[model samples]
Target: MATGDAKLILPFNSAFSSSYWMRWQTPVCFLITVSPGIAAALMLYRLKRRRGCDHLPAAATWAPCFRGVPPLVLPVYRGLVVISMISVLYCLLRLNGLVEFYFYTQWTFLLVIIYFLIGTIISAHGCWVYYRQRRRQGVEEGNRFLTFNRDDNVDNHTALVTADNNSGGKLEDKRAGTWGYCMQIIYQTCGGAVMLTDVVFWCILVPYMSSAHFSVNLVMGCMHSLNLLFLLVDTLLNSMPFPWFRMAYFILWSCTYVIFQWILHACGFSWWPYPFLELATPWAPLWYFCMALIHVPCYGAYWLIVKAKNTYFPRFFPHSYVSL
Candidate 1:
């Protein structure tokens, strides 16, 4: 019942666009979005059911294989997470309240926030483990030094090496656990979601809808920009491997949102958040198909960034950098 450029509309009880569901475009739009969702769902199911198919190395660790990376990286990264979360929350507050959460931008932003929160907890545990291992190694080395008997000292050193190997094996097993998989999937999903949200908002919505339905403000700008900014910084810092197969999860994420919109409209909710999503238009099929195809480049671009970092960093800073 909102008026003017409010982007709200009366439910089905109000006057209908007679052509809304009557056109051939409706089913075409449905197929464009939902078919990929179905295929992606099946792909994920098989991935989980099949052994050796999905290898989720722990993305939570500062450096998975190499301990030479400074332990301070964890604490500093946690500080960045806290700052990013606060800024996003402030922007949400400026947009009014929880009602703003209705938009997909907010959904993706919230996912990024959740990822950071989970990351903070995991990284804190890593910091404790790092310092504890350093202390244990120092104490053991000191005890070996006190034993001047060279043979006995050698035996003690061998025992320490064996124990370290056992602990490392356990850590590798932990990396394949369920929580590790969740973190990796969330990271990949956020990669695609943020890209799509920003691109559509700035390039399409801002140009076309700004004069009529869309309002561009500082808070809205930050919501779009900061989501990608924070995620990009995390990608640069974290040791996570971005396997391209996890793009299935990204497709599923967007599909769920599109299906949600369809369900709302079916239930007599009238508002279409973006005009291209409106099925009443004859171009709806074209828009939906284009949206579907755009996922590839959106995700591929982020993948390329990660690939470039891994390829170039080790060469440039051979002493300091470690590629995942």
Candidate 2:
């Protein structure tokens, strides 16, 4: 087939048949479209509003990161922000014409970096404030410091926190101040952003959308792997607590992007950064719906990873810093 003819083919089309749906009108596609929505909804339903961080699970194995950023995790988390910021700047300055600038992969990469930057800044500020407050009060010698969710939760939709008596009454349920709250918002929002960004890039864009001559460069490679890597490392070190319902923020984030794209197209730009986003095709709605549904799983899987790390690590390595 001619190159021009190939370009005209719908993204879902292949060599054997023109339409992928026609070739495989089976249960798999139906499950893929419907399952994520149901699952995400169920997870949201499970979150009950609590008066305080009383419901916040207090596992001896895992520390609550939502309050104050751990002093140790700072370096790795900031390192990711640095790497991502540099990678993005390099791409924008050096490879401007070689890449699709507005593509979701690029957008997500940028978003993750922004998230890290905001989070790191807030954590640093909060930590400084914490120390200054300590010095001002003339208190010293205790390892446990009072922080938000130290014992109480302020959010109306916050889930229950599990108690760990083994903590020897060390964890306090203090209110998260301005900086702490900012960091919490950014941290929770990032839970889904990281997964959604990485999954789409690795599973869809790079494999199917990248052009024939497009080869993975150092930055390209780092951009994909490092986002997830940084978050996982943060998971191991930070005291931020991630709950399942926070995926709602992630959904809203993606929806905002789609709306922005629509607005841009409405103004005059005709190009869609991704072929899956093109509405001219008959299966466009299906594509959109499936993409929406997939968010739940992608987000859920990452949550599970955090939960798994929190659950198993203490049992396996009781003396690790992860064990509060």
Candidate 3:
């Protein structure tokens, strides 16, 4: 039966000859992959134009909803950084140094690490600002107490106080700038990529498609599980908003990987990391279409998780937790 199965399936190839393009499945598969990518790009463009840069609040980049302090989320982000880096390094060493980075699992894992790294830096800055604000606030209160009811410098003092208050308010309300948005885009992209990577690996690939090229092992298990686990913890502790519009970026991430795989094969590198991604099969179009559509649910699952967090956190921890 194994030999019969091998005989029935088309062998993997590296070169894309003229006949390869001539096949109906080839063009259809290309269309399936390219169409979503184009649509996602346009959707992101329109969203940026319509919502403007300030749509994602700056406070969310640093602050934790469960607590009023912006710095409270720092430890969680730092832990994520350490764990993700160690997991990624272990996978690379266990599999095949740099070559293992070719898998989407590595791509998503690296992306998660990047998000946490950026989050940690931003959180550290938030902590500094938080402490500075506290010190200034104490000094201001002391000054007010000492100068209470003084009429000697009333006008000058009033103007100076007003100016100082305005400056502090502006600083506190600072916008999330370009880097903040970049961090957010990566976070949301990782959300979907993590889900897709795990679901495909555990549900479909493990059951039906496992082989020598894609073996089941501890390293691979951690690659799928830890990505989801870390991100979930982040989602719970961090104040970042998970907007549905950001799903566009996730689609583009997956599409970019597909294009990368296609390019590698065109350059004579045979063997797909995931069998469903092969374009040579007659069912290629179906696989491509299904993969493209799967992004919705994969993304939706994470979005729902965020929604659930926001919904139930306040109810459960009424005193300590607040929704983002």
Candidate 4:
């Protein structure tokens, strides 16, 4: 039945052609395809209005202020949302037979684009809710730690301070320790490196790999999965206050991914980005297991860096930093 439908929708020669129309039609197709997403967004907006928070803060607003650095939610969301809209447009064009040439060759691209747009929109909405709470409570603008009184001698090291920085006395801005600052720099560096590498791999490497019969959709899926996993871990680590809770969250989330991968693999599917695992000769599950293990060190390094900043450079990493 699927085969008959494929033939009806896509012709033999048109399916395999390599042309500009095939490659570039995605954005136009995505715009037309995003009706469901638009509908969903409108529905959500109406629901929120009905709940009585007319001026509710966006989800990005509640993102934990890492020291003074506002969470990088907006940029990420903007990029993903744009890509998703493009994907939706692409799907619409393909389904409607708007692009005559090479339609079959680009089917996988359509699916990948759709997956990304949907996933990012869902995740971004959750983040929006988080920031809204912070904005409404006024905590979004204050230091996450060390509440102080204006009348107190804030300079005195002997005095204990509240984390909220809202005590009756003037708040003292404590300098972060040298190690903490160093960690912050390292975390930022690592985060940047990971993102840059992933982008390069997707935009450049994947096309080359596809020449060898690599599944682009599969590769994209894996990459997106990895990205989601990393972001989830990073968010928890940076947002949580206590070390124990941070570690616990990391473990729980990591285990969840492990289980998800395992189940998918057992069911004859590969759901992660590191294509090396799927490309292995023996098809060992252990290879995928090891790939996941790499996250431990990556996250561990990130945690160490954040921990150092919090411990050493408290003033530099104030909790009150907000970015629009």
TM-score of each: 0.81, 0.66, 0.82, 0.32
What pairs collide in candidate 3? none
Q: Across residues 1-324, which tens digit of lDDT does each residue of candidate 4 receive? A: 011112224223332223322333333333323333354456546654674222211222223434244444533753554465455444444444443112211232333343334334433553553355346445633332222333444322212222343554333333333333333333333342344334435554556554433434433344334443444344433422222212222333334433444344444443333343333334333443443445445455555655665565446544543211
Estimate, for each residue in 219-301, the C-alpha lDDT of model 3 and write its tens digit.
66776788898788778877788888889899888889988887777666666777788777888889889899999999999
Q: Which stretches of candidate 4 lie over 4 Å from their true place?
A: 1-210, 214-248, 261-289, 308-324
Model 3 spans with C-alpha error above 4 angstroms = 1-19, 51-54, 68-76, 90-94, 139-172, 211-213
State the lDDT at 113 in candidate 3. 84
Residue 225 CA error for candidate 4 (Å)?
12
Candidate 1 lDDT over residue span 31-127, tens digit each: 9998999899998888789887655434344443233456557557756866766686665554455656557887888888877776677767656
Candidate 2's residue-wise lDDT over 163-228, tens digit each? 335653343434455545545545666767768777776777767754663445556666677777
Q: Give the higher-lDDT candidate: 1 or 3.
A: 3
| Model 1 ranges off by over 4 Å | 1-19, 64-69, 139-174
Task: Order the numbered candidates by lDDT, best leading.
Answer: 3, 1, 2, 4
Error of 2 at 29 (Å): 17
The candidate with the higher TM-score, 1 or 2, is: 1
Off by over 4 Å in 2: 1-80, 97-101, 126-140, 146-172, 213-215, 321-324
Better of 2 and 3 by TM-score: 3
